[model samples]
Target chain A: MIAAVLLSLWIGSSTSSIAELRHALFSPDERVSDIAIREIRWPRTVTALAAGAALGMAGTLIQGHTRNPIAEPGLLGINQGAALAIVSVAVFSGPLQPWPQALLALGGALAASLIVFGIGRVDGRGASPITLVLVGAAVTALCAGVVSAIVLLSEAALETLRFWQVGSVVQGYDSFLALWPLLLAGTGLAMANARGLNALTLGEDSARALGITAPRARGIGLAAIVMLSGLAVTLAGPIAFLGLLVPHVARRIFGADYRWVIPGSAVCGALLLVVADVLGRMLARPGELPVGVVVAMLGAPFFIYVARRRKPVTV
Target chain B: MSARRTAPTALLLFLATLAVLCLHLSIGGTPIPLPDVVGSLLGISPDPRTELAIMEFRLPRSLAALCAGVGFGVAGALTQTVARNPLASPDILGVTNGAALGAVALLALTSQVQGLPMFLHAYGLPIAATLGGLLVSALVFSLVWHSSLESNRLVLVGLGMSGLCAALTSWMLTLGDVYNAQQALTWMAGTVNGVSWADLAIAPLVIAIGVALAAALRNQREVLALDSDTSRALGMDLGRDRIIMLGLATALAVAATVIAGPLAFVALASGHASRLIARSTVPPVAHSALVGAIFVLLADLAAARLFSVVLPAGVATAVIGAPYLIYLVIRQTRVRSA
Candidate 1:
């Protein structure tokens, strides 16, 4: 992941040699290459790293707690909820900085999760994973519908929204920086709860026998997920499937243990997103595809493949 | 699933449609008095202004909404019956996104270094959209058609595909210049704004044929909800009928998108609404169509008048429809559990 991030930082529209990259890193001077590396490439790479890692962790926590392999922030409507909140600020409130916007986003994500979970659990047996997904899809569509309405009604909102609506790691150095502390706190919380989560995965009855209070552990897991997902979404709009794909990849590499899966997910997601971003930069020369779009283009096929090859998804 | 259509329910729906259609025709960016609207319709209005508004603007727009609504409503009903799932509307099933993506892809390809070739540009969107929708239906049908179709997997996979297509559309927009992006985005937002006589031309013909095709296959289409052996015993070829039903549904939805830019919820809401109004588990095709038309017309009316700015009609429908979808989901879950 570190190598991938470093590689992304060096290569973009204007390629800088390793020597130039080293010079930019160590003996930074007022050179065009140095400035590009310092200002443009570095921040973009870091933003992707932070957002990707957070999303990957959030997916891990969400899937772990939900006991649903397909669960992710986007599929759970968490990201849309956060984005809707930020967009609402852009539309209704005067204007907010990145810090305040992200705070608003966290609140929004929490609200959406409650609604989604509430709707899902209405089934009486608790909402099945499939049910949660279906309800989440509906909620995401609804939020997106409302967001579009807000954008259409206000010019000021549109200017900010059109770009954000499509998730990207375009230009948000401050926002990304704002997320760093929360990301650390959330990651720490997730890692701390990992051992309990692994036990909880044995089902609530077994988890209770193992002396893990299932509900309390699940609550911690949800909070961590909300923090990671909300902040990531606020930093970059909503990068679809990052959370869903990464945990699976992580588990493939490191096994189902939450301790290994969490960090592994962070590594895999950051690497994947950074590479996707770089590839996106290369794909459209003067212009660029959003990293989110590239991820979807790649992830959608993978999603189908997984859905097809696996056991029929159930509760 | 079929039940007797109650007279009072039919009368209620009929009156609602008539009243809304009248309201739709009589009002616009500027409201014309009811007398002037009727006078213009009868060619007896003294004012040329009233005639122009009625003929050139208001009439075409309202007609487009009604026809498109009916098309979407019928399509929604067909799809729901075929899938045996009320949630399987064109929009939810990714047909709308597929059509929109196909149309936008065509637009982008043609408009790329130079604008679209005039012939393709002028006549291309509906064709592209319909073909796109058909393609998606084929893919969706094949994916879920494991000896027998599984509606659950179909909806799940369809939702995934819809999101994927939307992402692809967004990518295409990003690659295109700003003006094209704006145009495509507005279309995807789904609106009947600026619909004209030209826009309404192909829809009526296509819808008429599609509805006739659906009616002809109505018995076989309903047999879809039956198990394959029973349907076979009943002289229905499950595969052939399913394809024909899906094809017709896709065409109707494509027709709706052709006029309304993939308007949301009408397909889903109208089907469910019509089913309730007709008091049948089988959504009555005619009732669904009528209810759909009334729904869109009313939604458009709210969008145009209820807002300080004219909002897209799709947004209004979604605002009303999505919650209803959630409610339906909750209710369905409850029923199943019970």
Candidate 2:
């Protein structure tokens, strides 16, 4: 991850040498490459790492709780929810500062998840995984519909959304300052839920037999997911498939233990995003593709592969 | 469920569609009287402004809605029938996003590449959209196919593909300038706003032929709804018929998407709406088409007239249809568990 961050700093629309990186770090000169490294690329690298780690951890927690291989924050309408809130604020009022925008996004994500969970919950228990996913899709469509309606109606809103909706990390460190504590809290919650998540993975009833309060464990798991994913979306604009992709990779490497999976996912997610950001810088040249778009390009095929491989359920 | 019983329901729906059409044509930001709209339709000039409003703007937009709605309706019915899943539709199955991706990519490219041939701009959009929808549908079908398509698996796989296509579409949006991105975004929301007669040239004809073809294949649609073994036992070639029907559905959906951006839920709701209204065991294609037309016309009317700002018809459909979908899913789960 550190190496990937260095690589991201080194490559940009204007290439910089390794000597320049050393100079930026040790000497702290005002050379163009040094300034570019400090001013533009460094903050972007931080944003990518923090946001990517948040998303990865979120994915691990949610998949662990749900035990559904294909589930992710985006799939469950959390990302769209954040997007809708941010876009609504932008449309109604002018663009918000990074702090307020992140807050609103977190609020929106919470509301949307609650709605999905509320409607999808059957009495005391959750709906079947497929039902919940379908409900989430419906909610996503609804939110997306409203967001686009607002965007299409106002040119200003369209301009704001066009950049933000695609998930860019170009905005720099203001978001990171506001976001890190929340990200830390979410990570802490995720880590704390690890043993509970492992128990839940053995099935809710079994988890109960193991003295884990199934609903409380699920709630904490969900809370962690919402916080982590919401901050990531606010920070990086709703990068799809990251949450879905990372946990699987984490599980492959770290086995089913949530203790390992949680940390593994965070590290892997940071690594993936840092690498993707570097690639995005390289691919578009000068303008640069958004890290979200780059990740989508990388992660969507994996999503399809997982979908294809999962055993088809009998109707 | 009988054809005889469905006749009056169909007629009622057709009349409702015409009423909605007239309502759509008569009212806008500048409201023209019904008499003026009627007079303009009859080739009588109700003054040049009214004439332009009716003949140039409203007519094409209304007709586009009508045609696209019909296409979505039929396509939705066909998809549902083929998959044996009421929840399966073009939008949900990634077909609409696929079409949107194609159209948006072309729109972005035309703006980015500079000095593209005029013919590509004029004719390329529908072709690109159709090809994209077909390609995604093929991918979804192939991914899910292992001896047979389980309805649940098809939807899940389709959802996965939809996410991928949506990401690509967003990427395409970023490739273009702000103006182009705005245009693509509006279109992606399934608006018929600013649709000129020229923009709608191919959609009407294609929809007409597709609907006619669907009506002709009514018997096959019915047979294909049965279990594969039963369908084969009845001397039907299940594989060939399924492909032809699915292909036809894709074509219809693509044609509709070309006219208006993938109008969400018109297809999904149309099938179920028509089925309920007609009290049919299966969604009747003709009735579904009429219902779909009504759905779009009403949605457009609500979008354009009801809002302080004109929103896309797709927004209205989604806002309305998504809840209905939730209801259906809830009902289905209840029934299943019971």
Candidate 3:
């Protein structure tokens, strides 16, 4: 699915104008279609794919670890944390320098996850699914408040960060090139834990009986969550609904197997985002809607249907 | 159950609310002493500046907060009781987001309608929002009707509906011109800022109607909270009562959302707080009202006075209330584990 999306994006970029496309491919003219493709479309596609996959993996890990069908990076406040951090950086500092924002976002996401995890875990026991969700909601609300405070304080900052906060992909493409290593590391970690995650799903006691250390499994799961969600937020400004939507679609198509579900989610997420981005670009004609808005438009109703249909999975 | 025993708690809560209201009136960038604030309220000295600050600015805002908070608290209580889910609230029932979306849509569609009397415009938004909320509730209730309104499922459905409403709102904003988008965004954040006398007037009537209805069904709600089977066994019309309660709750939620964006966590936190304070199986609605009023009044005051940056009261409540919610969740988990 991801490959198809990439191919389509390439075709879409190339098909805008044959002469411009030829110039972009072979010409020294920086203003031609070739530069647009290589600099803009290519980087945008890569960022979307990386971010979507990371979000997908993160959502899957959250749902699996918590055993909550509704769990997602957004639900757990990771995205809000990242967004808040970015907003702070923009407000206090100036125009967004990419690497710093990414690092700050990563730290913020980790901090939020840890805080939520701590709140969810009471009396030194594993957290309940509902408890985790509610705690996440609370934390997210607080983070949103902080974001609002910052926005209200600085009109310039609000103007600069508002578009990004709303989940646009039009920001510095050059910055994304620097994030490849982080994305690779996170993706690798997530993939490596697929087997452990599979075992961990068979109830903690059963997993322990089968020689899987439940604590170790949970630790690894947390690491995967932090890495994937952090990286995803770094790449795209907290695009919600996709993380929740993609994994469910993957589970339905590929069954409950983690190996399939995880990779399937990544593929579906990438495809969904690319399509959403493309649709966003096309729908508005001259003025483009953000990919995040497009994804929400697509995902919300589907999310509602799935949520209503599924029985609650108690952790 | 002794009225005499309960009197102190009620009195304490009322006094606390009044104190917060007084503090709200007194504190701001231009601080007024409590005595002068009191004088202005009593109409003794009749200071025009104080009157403008109190009646024009603080009064409307405080009233907005009171109305919104009460509406949310009662709505939250009703929702939790009807759904039999501690997590269930107006936001979980999609009422808040539905109202927000409807309001946003109206704002987006109507360009020249901004300067009109706020009451007229406000009425449109809440009505549209309530309709949207009702549509979602009806849909979810029907969907889950086959297998009972499972607490978790109801919440999940509500969350999904919220997301959907939010998406539609975002889409509308994106389609809108810059000014419309700005207005829509401000409305979405659940701010009590810029509320006027007109806004205040609408809320009291809507909230009063909702409160009257909720009060009438309070006994039925309490009975229903004892479990549907028990209520049914007692010859109560459980379904009819549930529908009425749900409608009343949704209406209150819509009215509150219209007055004060979504005001995150108030409905959830206030209802929970009231239940905890009352320590009752069924939520204490009157206590919830007091708590809600106090909570919002304090939140607004904090936003107006405490913060160097002028943050919205909604934002302040979330900052404070969310931590408490987290504590509640963790505490609940511990209890369940034990």
Candidate 4:
């Protein structure tokens, strides 16, 4: 992870000398490279780390709670919900301050997930993986339809949406600073929920026998996922496939233990995003490709590979 | 249910598609009388101005919607039959995304490059989109074909490929002029608003061939719906039949996409809608095609007339389709749980 962060900080459209970077790092110099490094590169690198880690942890929680290997925060309609809310608010009442934007996003994400869960559930039992995913797809389509309608209706909304539609780490540090607490809270919640997730994985009845209280555990886990994903979307827009693939990578590396998987996903997710961001910067040259684009391209083949290897009916 | 039971449903759907097509033709900017519209469609000129409006403007748009709908329906029926999964469609299987990426890349490229030839500018997109859809379908089929194509694996592989294609298309959006981006957005939303006779030159012929191919595969489709082992036990060549069906479906999807820019849910919903109405085991190809045509025509009508600002037909279809999808899922859940 450190190596990945260093690589992101060092590489760009233009590279700075090592001595200059070192001098800038220590003395807060006023050179162009220093300013770029401090203002643009540093925040972007940190934002990437924070958002990636949050999404990775969120993905782990979602997959664990849903017991669906294919589940991701994005697949749960959280990203679309947050996007719809942000776009609607922006169109109706101008751009908001970062705090309100984040709050609205969190509200949107929570509402969307709740809707998916509510509609997906049959009887009192939680939805099957296929049902959850299908419902998620429907909700996502619905949100996207409305969003496109609003975007088409207003030029101001269209301009705002064009940038927000693609996930990028090219956000101001202020936004990151404003939302970092929620990330920390979400991470802490995820860590706390890990053991319960492990217990619940055995089965709800077995988890109940173990005194794990499946509903409470799922509730906490769901909250963490929504918080992490919502805030991550706020900081970096919606990064596709990052949340979906991170937990699988973590499980492959750290085994099925939730305690290990949670932290492993965070580190791996951070490393992957930073590397993808660096690659995006390098590949596109003068204008960088969005990190979301790069990650989706990179993650898709892995997704296909996973799908091929897994059994058809179950994880 | 057999053909006898479904024939009436098919006939009704056919009449409905024609009625919707007429309504689509007559209700645009200037409302032409039904007699005049019918006359224009039958090669009789009501007058020069009305004839121009009907023959030149509305006819092409209506034909684009009809042909595109037929293509999507045939493709959807073939795919769903082969996959044996109710949810499978060319849209879900990455063909739409691939085609959209291809078309958008061409438009963005042409917009950036100065003094491109008019021929390439005008005709490049459909060919590019068709090639793109075919290439991605080939990639998807190749990836999933380990001896025989498995149903869930095919859908999952397609989903992954579509994700990649969608990402590339979005990145392409940032390439050139913002005006070009808006144009790409409108097209990607699946509008038939600006389709002209020239834009649709290849659509009718390709769609006809697609329908023929689908008809040829009707027997195989029924057998393919059974378990692969069962079908193979009954002397059906699972691998060969799946390849043919998927290939035919991909071609039809490409044809439709080139005309209407991936109309969102026609392919996904048409098969199910037809089966629901016809009470058939498999979505009958002819009935599904008629249902698909009516779906797009009605969607286009709503898109053109119901909105304060004209939106793409794809938007209306999605709005209609998503809820229907949710309802389907819920019903499936109920049946399974019950």
Candidate 5:
């Protein structure tokens, strides 16, 4: 992860040398290289790391609580929820001040996730993982419809959101720093839920027998996901597939224990984003591809692979 | 349930579709009065401008919707029957996304590959899009083919592939300049607004062929919903039938996506809508095609007239389709339990 941070700082549209990177690290504000590295790349790196960690944690919590193999923030309408809120705000108001945008995104994600869960819980039939995913797709389509309607309504708003709508972190550090408080609070809440998440994975009956309050724990876990996913979208743009695949990868490496899975997912998620952002910069050259786009490129294949596996997928 | 599958209901649906189509032509931002529209259609109008609007602009757009709707409807019905799942539509099964990806890839590639051959340039996108849809459908089927073909597995896998294909398309959109991006975005939104006769040239042909193929497979459609073992017992070549059905669906969906972007929910809802309208236990493929045409034509009209802004037909479809999907889950499950 540290190497990834350094690696990200090393590359950009404008090339910088290793010596310049070292100098920027210690001397602080000595040269143009120092400022570019410090002001531009360093903040992006931190934002990527923090946002990735949050998404990873969110995916872990949601998947564990739902006990659904395919339960993912993107697959479950959280991203679309955040996106709809952000788009609505941008369309209604002018350009958003970053702090308030993040808060609204968090709120939207929570609302969307709750609706998805509620729909899934509507009947005994809708509660399966298949229904959850199908409902998520339907909700996402609905949100996309609403979004395009709003986009048609306002050209000025599209101008403001066009690039951001693609999901890049090119806006440097102001929004990233603004997102710090929420990221910290969300992560703290997630780590606290690690033990409870493990209990819920044992099924509701066993979980209650083991003295765990399944509903309250699931609610808290969902709150963590909403906060983390919201902040990530606000910090980055709405990177899909990161939260979907990262936790599964984390579980593969760290086993089923939430104690390890939570932190493991966090590290892996951060690593994936930092690497993706750097790769996006390198792949497209001077015109950098957005990190969210890159994650989708990679994550989609992983999604198919997991779906094709022989192990019977449990809801 | 089978007794109600009569000719009158199907004829009613067909007549209603025509009425909707006629209404779609008459109404828009500037409401052309029904009398004038009828006059233009009958070639008795004195005003050339009214005739021009009816012939050049409105006629082509309406035809595009009608053709695309029929394509998606038949495709959706075929897919749903074969998969034995109401949700089995081109958009859900990754075929639509595959076509979208292929078209976008060509668009992106054309910009990248300067001085490309004129022949390739003219035909590349549609052909590529169709092939892409077929390839993805084949892949999804293969992935889902295990000890036994399962609807849930196919859907789940298709959903994954669809997401990936959509992502790839988005990445391609970002690679180009602003004009291309805007054009692609509009197309992606699934509108028939700017479709020229030239733009829609091959879609109708593909759709016609797809419809013919669907008609040929009508016999197999009933048996498709039966158990695989029972189908095999009935001397049905389950593998061959499934492939042919999948091919037909892919072709239909690809035809729709090529002309307009992947118009969401049309294929999924059309099959079920016809079932409800005709009150048939079996998925009414013939009615589904007509119902699909009606749905998209109405959606296009609603999208154009309902908002000050010209919304995509897809948005209006979702306004109806999303809730319908929710209702499907509840109603179907309730029926099963009862």
Candidate 6:
């Protein structure tokens, strides 16, 4: 997957320098090749990898914590919250700034998480997965409604946000650069808690008996989800299916152990996203398809198959 | 089950709906005094502009709300009954998204076809939207029909279809230039803006079809409320009945979507609400319709007049409905726990 994505990146970048490709690859000067590799291909490749990994990790965390198979960020209202916040910024503000949009998206995501958490926590023992999903669906629908209203009311913002809303990876390198700190922090936390997450799968009572504070573990898991999801949204809009798809694929390959599942999902997610980004770049020639759209087109069928095959899991 | 308790609750609901209608008519940007509005309704007022404004703008808007609401309500109730799941609705079934995609696509493709007669456009949009919705419903039905129609599987398929439709819609928006994209985006979000006399005409006809079909399916749906095997054991043609009920529900959903553009959660939430009020395991269709109409009418009124900057009624419903849904889930959890 990595090689494929790299090859696609090379092809995309070389479009502007088609005449010099053979010389650039084996030249003594090496300046042209260096510039092409560093300036054009590297940022796009890295961002795609990072964004995909973040979403994959986030999806795994949500599925693990909630114990629900279908709980992607998009399905759970996190994406909608982040998208709404970002759109609000793009529409209301003249130019797009990464930090503020990131902060606002983080805020919206956290707010939505809290609401879902609260709803799930109703039994004094957290929400059932089904209830949580329903609540998320409700919140997602509501947020979509509000976002639509805002877009309607503000034409300029709507124009700017349309592409972003479609989930692109081409917001330039700055947005990717801006997301690095959050990505590092989130990934680091999630990796650190892999054992705890695995313990969580044994059921709350059993995990508690095994010396994990179920609530604290859940809280940590929630934090990890927020960070990863926030960073992913900041980098590449709300690409759906990555988080849901990557982790499920990882689980199918690596079994249900969080120790393996978490890292496996991360790698799988990065690869999936990079390949998707590469495909998006190549599919329409010069005018790129957004990675989000590519993933959806690819992911939707897989998701349906997963849904049909699996028995419903509790959150 | 006391008569005294049932009578008062029904009475209260009726009065509340009436009060909401009055509020809808009386309140707007140019607020006519409540008495003048009431007097105009009674044909006693001589103030022609206020009357015209109230009769023309407010009345149709309120009526549209009522019709859409009831349509949504019946659709929701039918979905819940058929699926035996509280979360099931036309929106979840991909009907609304499908309809909206159809309508928006038509509008986007026909940029040159603007300024046509209002009647032509009105008929055109709903027809296109209904076709889109029915198409999706057909796809979903076909995909899930091989298996026993489990509610969970049906919802899962619906969710998948909705995601696909949403992606397609987003892609369409992205492909369009800024102006057309903006228009499509807003329309997808849903608005009662630009509603006209012709639009009103489509509502009544579709709604009539929905209601008549719903009435016809009343007994069959009740049987369907029982488990599939039980319904079948009772000599009902489970497969055929499921198809008919689903078809009718889809029609209601398509109609509501055409009129209101997937007004968020009205169908699902209102059906749930009616079930709660009816205190029955199965949602009564008539009660659901009444509840849906009340919910939509009130929501529309609130959207139009509540805030200084008028939001679309869809936005208002979602804002209010989403949190309430959370509360309901929490409440259900608590009940289950106890």
Please write out the lDDT profile of model 3 over residues A1-315, one tens digit for every residue: 645554534554234565665566566366755666766776677777878888888888888887877677877889788878778878767656677877888888999999888877775756666676677778887898888877877775686566555333446354467777876777777777777778888887888888888888788888888988888877777677788888888888998788888889888887887777777777765566667777777776776676666555432
Relative to the true structure, candidate 6 has a C-alpha RMSD (angstroms) of: 4.7
* TM-score-best of 1 and 4: 1
> lDDT score of model 2?
0.82
Clashes of 3: 2
**Residue A290 lDDT in model 1?**
80
Q: Flag clash pairs in model 1.
A: none
lDDT of 3 at B316: 82
The ten-residue window of minimal lDDT in model 6 chain A covers: A13-22
lDDT of 2 by residue, A88-195 (tens): 888878767777888888998998888887777753455677787888889988998888778767666676666565444455367777678898899999999999
- Off-target runs (Cα >4 Å) in candidate 3 are A1-38, A88-96, A123-125, A154-160, A163-172, A202-218, A255-257, A310-315, B1-4, B112-123, B145-150, B178-182
- Clashes per model (N, Cα, C within 3 A): 0, 0, 2, 0, 0, 4
Q: Rate the local accuracy (lDDT) of all candidates.
A: 0.80, 0.82, 0.75, 0.82, 0.81, 0.75
Clashing pairs in 4: none
Evaluate every candidate with DockQ and list the scores: 0.60, 0.55, 0.62, 0.58, 0.63, 0.47
TM-score (C-alpha) between model 1 and the true structure = 0.95
- The total of clashing pairs for model 1 equals 0
Tell me the chain A TM-score of model 2: 0.92
Q: Report, to 2 decimal places, the DockQ of model 6.
A: 0.47
Q: Which residue pairs does candidate 2 place in steric collision? A: none
For candidate 5, the C-alpha RMSD (Å) to the true structure equals: 2.2
True-structure RMSD, every candidate = 2.3, 2.7, 3.6, 2.8, 2.2, 4.7
| Residue-level lDDT tens digits of model 3 in B258-285 | 7888777788888888777776676667
Candidate 5 per-residue lDDT over residues B282-310, each given as its tens digit = 57777888988998999988887887877
lDDT of 4 by residue, B1-338 (tens): 67788888888888888888989899988799998999888888679899999988899989998998898988888888887766778987789889988887887788789998898787888888888899999888787677336455676677788778888887777675533533675556788887888887887898898898787777888898888889889998888888888888998998898888877778889988887888877888998899889888888888778867878888888888888888877887787788
In candidate 5, the residue pairs with backbone N, CA or C atoms under 3 Å apart (3 or more residues apart, or in different chains) clash, namely: none
For residues A42-79, write the lDDT of model 4, one tens digit per residue: 98889889888988999888888877777788777887
Write candidate 6's Cα lDDT for B1-338 as tens digits: 33454455556676777777777778777778889878888888768898898788778777777778888888888888887877678877788888887876666555545576676554677777888899998888778777736646777777788877776766555544424532553455555655656668766687878877786766787788899878878888887888888888888888877777777778878888888887767676666877888888777777666655567778878887877666766776676789
Give the worst 10-residue stretch by lDDT in candidate 6 chain B. B176-185
